[model samples]
Target: MVATVVQMTESKTQIQHTHRVFENQKKAFRNNPMPSSSERKENLKRLKRALLANQDRLLEAIDRDFSCRSKDESLIAEVMPSIQGINYTLKNLDSWMKPSKRHVSVLFQPASNKVHYQPKGVVGVIVPWNYPLYLAVGPLVASLAAGNRTMVKMSEFTPHTSSLFKEIIEGMFPEDLVSVITGEADVAADFSRRPFDHLLFTGSTSVGKLVMRAAAENLTPVTLELGGKSPAVVSPDVPLSDAAQRIAFGKAINAGQTCVAPDYVLCPEDRVQAFVDEFRAQASTMYPSLRDNDDYTAIINERQYDRLQSYLEDARAKGAEVIEINPANENMKDGTRKIPLTLVLNATEDMKVMQDEIFGPILPIVTYTDLDDAIHYINERPRPLALYFFGYDRAQQEHIIDQTHSGGMCINDALMHVAQDDLPFGGVGDSGMGHYHGKEGFMTFSHQRAIFSKQKFNSGKFVYAPHGTAAHKMIYKLFIR
Candidate 1:
C-alpha cells in the first residue's frame, strides 16, 4: 500500500515537471517567434552530429531494450534514415521557408499578397517503441526544420533507449528549445494533454484515437502516423519468387514491427503454395539461423511476444494453415522471445491475426482470384498506411492507383517508399492522416501566415463603408460582373 502511494506521488511529481517543461518551451517559442534559416540549419547539423557521434551507444541502448535487436537492422531501419532525414531537411530548409508570393487580384492593384511560413510554437512528438530512434529523430528533424520548439515523449516500452535519448538530448539542447520526456503510460497521457501547438504521434490506431482526443482539449492540430494492416498485392503475371522475396524482406525487417510493413499478401489463388515456398526460401536465406542468430531480430518484449503467440494460436484454432520457417530448425521454445518468420495460409476475417494489425514477423497470405478482388478486399477494410503492388504492367498499376487509397504506395517494391527523401509519407482514413516527410513535413509544423501590404494607395477603402455610393457601385459593377 505504501509502495503504491509512493508510486502515485512520483508520477504526480513527474507530470508536474513535464508541464513545467512544456510551459518553458512555449515561453521560449513566444520570445523568439521566428528562428533564422541559418539557426535552424545549425540545429539540424548539431542533431546529426550528435547522432553520428553516439551511433554505437544508441544502437547498444536499442539492443538492450529489445533483448535481441539486430545491430544491422538498427543501422538500416533507425540510424541511416534519421541521418538522411536530417540531411534532406537541411538541404531544403531555405526554399521551404521562403515567403510565397501569392497573386493579388487586379481589383486590389496597390496591395501585395504573400504567405509567410512561421513556426507553430511548440510541437509534441510521441515516439513509438519500434524503430524508436528514427521515429523520434525523424519528427524532430521536421520540427527543427520548421523552426519550432519541440518536446519528444519517448515510449516506456523502450526504456533503455528512451533514457539514453533523454540524456543525449539534455546534453545537446536546453529544455526550452528541445526536450525529451521519458516515463510510463500515465506520463504519456499527461504529456499528450499539454497544450502543444501541434502534436505528432506514431503508434497503434487505438492509442492514436486517445491521443487525438487529448489533443482536442487544447484544439491542438495533430499528425498521426497510426498503424493498420498494410497489404502487398501480387499481380497474376508477376513472378512469384520476386514478389515473395520482397514481401519477405519487408515483413522480416525489424521483425515486422514497422508501421509500414507488409501485414499480409494477396496472391493469385493457384500460386499460393509457390509464393509461400518462395517466401520461406527467401527468409531462410536472410537469416539462415534464428536461434542465437545476430542478424534476425527478436520480438520486442514478452508482452508483444505473447500477443503474437496468441495470434498464431487463435489463427490455428480457427483453421488457418501455419507454416513456420525456421531455417536451422533449432529449438525456439526458449526465453529468447524470437519467433520464426511464420506464414498464415487460408486466413479468415474472423481470426485475430487477420483482424488486427500484425505488428510482428507473422505474414498472412490471402488468395484472390482477380486483381479487383484484391483491390476490393483492401477497400472493404480500413485504409492502410502503405500498399505494395508487385507487377510490371503499367495499366494494372494505374488501375490500382486510381481505385484504392492509402497513405503511400510502392509499385514493384515494398518498404522502400518510406526511405525516399523526396516523397511525402502519411496515411489515409483509418490508417492515419497528414503528411510529414519532405515539403509536407515543413508545412505541417509551420503556420502559413497570410500577409497583405499596401504602400501608399487605399484601394480597399473604396468599398469600405457606404452602401449605395457611386464608387461602391462602380466597384461592385467591376467585381460582381
Candidate 2:
C-alpha cells in the first residue's frame, strides 16, 4: 500500500537525520577533544539548575505518564538522585581530570608515564520508562562529566515524560552538545546501529541483548544497566519483623517497579508466616489506603497491571498461597489501577513469577532452610543486580559477602547502597556488566589513554636489533626477573 511505503520512507528519513546529528556531535567533539575543567563544570551546573527549575513540571509529567506516580517518590527517586549525581560530579571534576602519574622502569630511565582521561566523543544513552528522568539524567551526568557530547533515546512507553524531557534537554543544551531523541522501537534500533564511541542502556535483559547485538556491528563499547531478580535475604538470626519492614519499604516505593527493588525475599521456613504478617502490617502503615493514597504509587499502566494480575493467578493456580494485603480493603475496581502488596508464598522455580523479574507490587517469599541453602539457591540462578541481607552478626555478614556474587550488596539494609555517592553501582554475570557512579562513572565514559614521555637525558639503546651483547644480557637479566 502507499501508506506503508510512506511510513517506511518517514522512518528512513528520521534515521538519516539521527545520523546527521551524530556527525554534528562528532564534529563538535573533534573541535574540542578535551573540554576545560571549568567548561565541564559549567555544563554540569547548568544541568543541575535545569533539573531544579523544572522539578515540578517533570514530576507532573511523570505522574501523568504513570497515571498515579507518587510525587514524593518522584522527588526521592528521580529528581533528588539526579541532582546529587550532578553535585558529586561537580565536586570531584578537578581531581578526576588531573592526569595520574606513573613510575617508569629503570630500563626506560629519563622517561615518565602518565594516564590522561579523555572523552569518548559521542555517547549514546538508551533510557527506560521506569524512573524515566533519573535513568536518563544519571547517564547524562556521567557522560557530561567525562566531557562527551551525548545523544539520548527516550522510551516510547512514556510519551508525556519523553516529550517534556526532550523540551527540557533542548532548553539547556544545543543539539550538537547534548541532544534528546524521541522515537519508537524502530528509532531505537536505528539509533543503536549508528556508530557511537560508547553506549549505555538501562532496561530489561532481553532488550539489552538486542541493543548490544546492534552495537556490536559498529564495535561500540557498551555499559548495560539491565535488571534481574534482585533478591533480599532475611537471615535466620534476624527477627522477622525487622527484615520485613526494611524489605517492605524498598518494594513499596514506586510500587515495586524499581530495578533494584527487592524482587523476592528468602525467609527461613519457620519464619515465613511471621515475615508475611510483618510485611502486611508495615505496608499498611506506609499506605493506609491504596485507592485514595498519593503516597502509594499505582502500577505504571493497565498492561503492566494485567501482567501482574496474570502472575498472581498463575502462581495461585499452581498451588502457591496468595496473600493480598489491602489495608483499607477498598474496591480496586473503582477505576484505580492499584494492586495491593501481594505476597506469593511457597513460590517454586517452576512458576512464572519465580522465573521472571517481577517489576510490580508482587513479592514472592521463597522459604529457605538455612544460610547455605539460601546461598546455594541464589548461586544456582543467574546473578542479580543487588543482594540485601538483614542481620546483626558480623561473622555471618562477612560469610555472605565472601560467598555470593552480585552487582552490589547492603548488610542490614535494602536499596541503600545505590544511594551512596562514593560507591560503584552495577551488576555481575547475567545481571549485566561494567560499573558507574562516583569515580567509576567517570572512568566508564572516558578513555584512560596512557602517555609516555622521554626527556633529553634518555639512556642509550641497550638492546639494538644487531647481536646480543654483555650489556643487553645484563639489562635483560635485571629487568626480566
Candidate 3:
C-alpha cells in the first residue's frame, strides 16, 4: 500500500515534469522557429562532443542496465553510430536546408516556385531499451539538424542508461532546447499522447499501434521504426560459408536484439543442414563460450529472458529441432539472463517464434525448394523492414529485387545498409512507415512549405473569371491539350 502510494506520487511527478519541459520547448521553438544551418551544425557538434566526452560513463550505465551488456558491443553499436550519424548530418545539413527549386507552369509565367524547409516546432523521440544510445541519438540528430527542439522519452527498462542520458543531456542543453523523460509504461503512454509537431517511435509493432493511435488524437505526424520478422535469403549458388558468416554476425550482434537483425533464414532445402552447420560454426567462433564470455551480451532483463526461453520451449513442443550452439557447453541458469545462440529448424507458422518478431539470438531456418518459392513465401507475409539476399548472380539478384517488397535490402550483406549515411531507412505495410536518416530524416522533421511568388505580373488573372476570356481559352488550349 505504501509502496503503491509512493509509486503513484513518482508517476505524477514525472508526468508533470514531462508536461513542463514540453511546454518550455514549444515556447523556445516559437522564439527561434528556424535556426540557421550553422546553428544546426553547431548543435549537432555539441551533441557529438557530449557523447564522446561521456562515452565511458554512458557505456558503464548501459552495461549496468543490461546486467551484462558488452562494452565492446556498446561502443560499436551505440556510441560509434550515434557519433557517425551526427557527423553525417553535419556534413549534409547545409544542402538539406537549402530550398528546393520546382518548375513553374507556363500558365503562371514570371512566377517562381520552390519549397522552403521550415523546422517543425518540436519533435518527440521515444527510444527503445535495446541500442538505447543509438536509437535516441539518431533521431535527435535529425531533429536538431532540422532546427527543432526535441524531448526524448527513454525506455524505463534501461533506468541506469536513461538517467545517465538525461543527466548528460541536461548538463549541456537547456531543457527548453533538449530534455529527456524517463518512467514506466504509464509515463511512456502519457509521453506519446502529448501534442508535438512530429513524433518518432522505435519499438515493437504492437506498441507502435498504440503510439500511432495516441498521436492521431492530435493528428501528430509520426515516423515509426518498428521491427518485424526480417529474413536473410541464402541463394542456392552462393557459398554457404560466406552467407552463414554474415548472417551469424548480424544475428550475433547485440545478441540479435536489433530491429533489423536477421530473424530467420531462407535457404534451399538441400543446403539447410550445411547452412545450419556453418552458422553454428561461425556463432561459436565469435563467442566461443556463453557463460563467462565478456563479448556475449545478456538479454536486457528477466522478463525478456523468460520470454525468449518460452519461445524455445514452444518451438520444441511444436517439433522444431532446437540446436543450442553452446561452444563451451556451460550452464546458463546462473541468473545472468544469457541464452546461447539457438537455432530452430523446421519452424512452423503455428509456433510463436514464427508468428512474432524474434528479437533475440534465436534464428529459425525455414527452407524452400526453390528461389521462386522463397520469394513467394516472403511476399505472402507482411512486408519486413529489411530483407537480405546472398549471392552474386546479377540476374537472380535483380529478380529478387523486382519481386518482393520490403523497407530496405542488403544484396550481399546484413545490417550494414543502415550504417550508410546517405540511404534513407524506413518501412512499409506492417513493418513500419515514414523515413528518417540522411535528407529524408531532415525532411521528415521539417515542413516543406511550397512557395509561389510573382512580382509586377498577374499571369493567373487570365483564368480568374468572366466566362473564360480569350487569354484563358488560349491557356486552356495550350495546357489541357
Cα lDDT listed for each candidate: 0.92, 0.90, 0.92
Q: Deviation in angstroms for 174 in model 1?
A: 0.9
Model 3 misplacement above 4 A: none
lDDT of 1: 0.92
TM-scores for every candidate against the unseen true structure: 0.98, 0.97, 0.98
What lDDT is obtained when candidate 2 is compared to the true structure? 0.90
User: Which 10-residue span in candidate 2 carries the lowest summed lDDT?
Assistant: 458-467
Clashing pairs counted in every model = 0, 0, 0
Q: Candidate 3 lDDT, tens digit per residue, 365-479?
A: 9999999999999999999999999999999999999999999999999999888888999998898999988888998999999999999978777777785678878887888
Task: Output the lDDT of residue 354, model 1.
Answer: 89
Q: Which runs of model 1 end up more than 4 angstroms from their true locations?
A: 1-3
lDDT by residue (tens digit), candidate 1, 152-213: 99999998999999999999988999999987789899999998899999999999999999
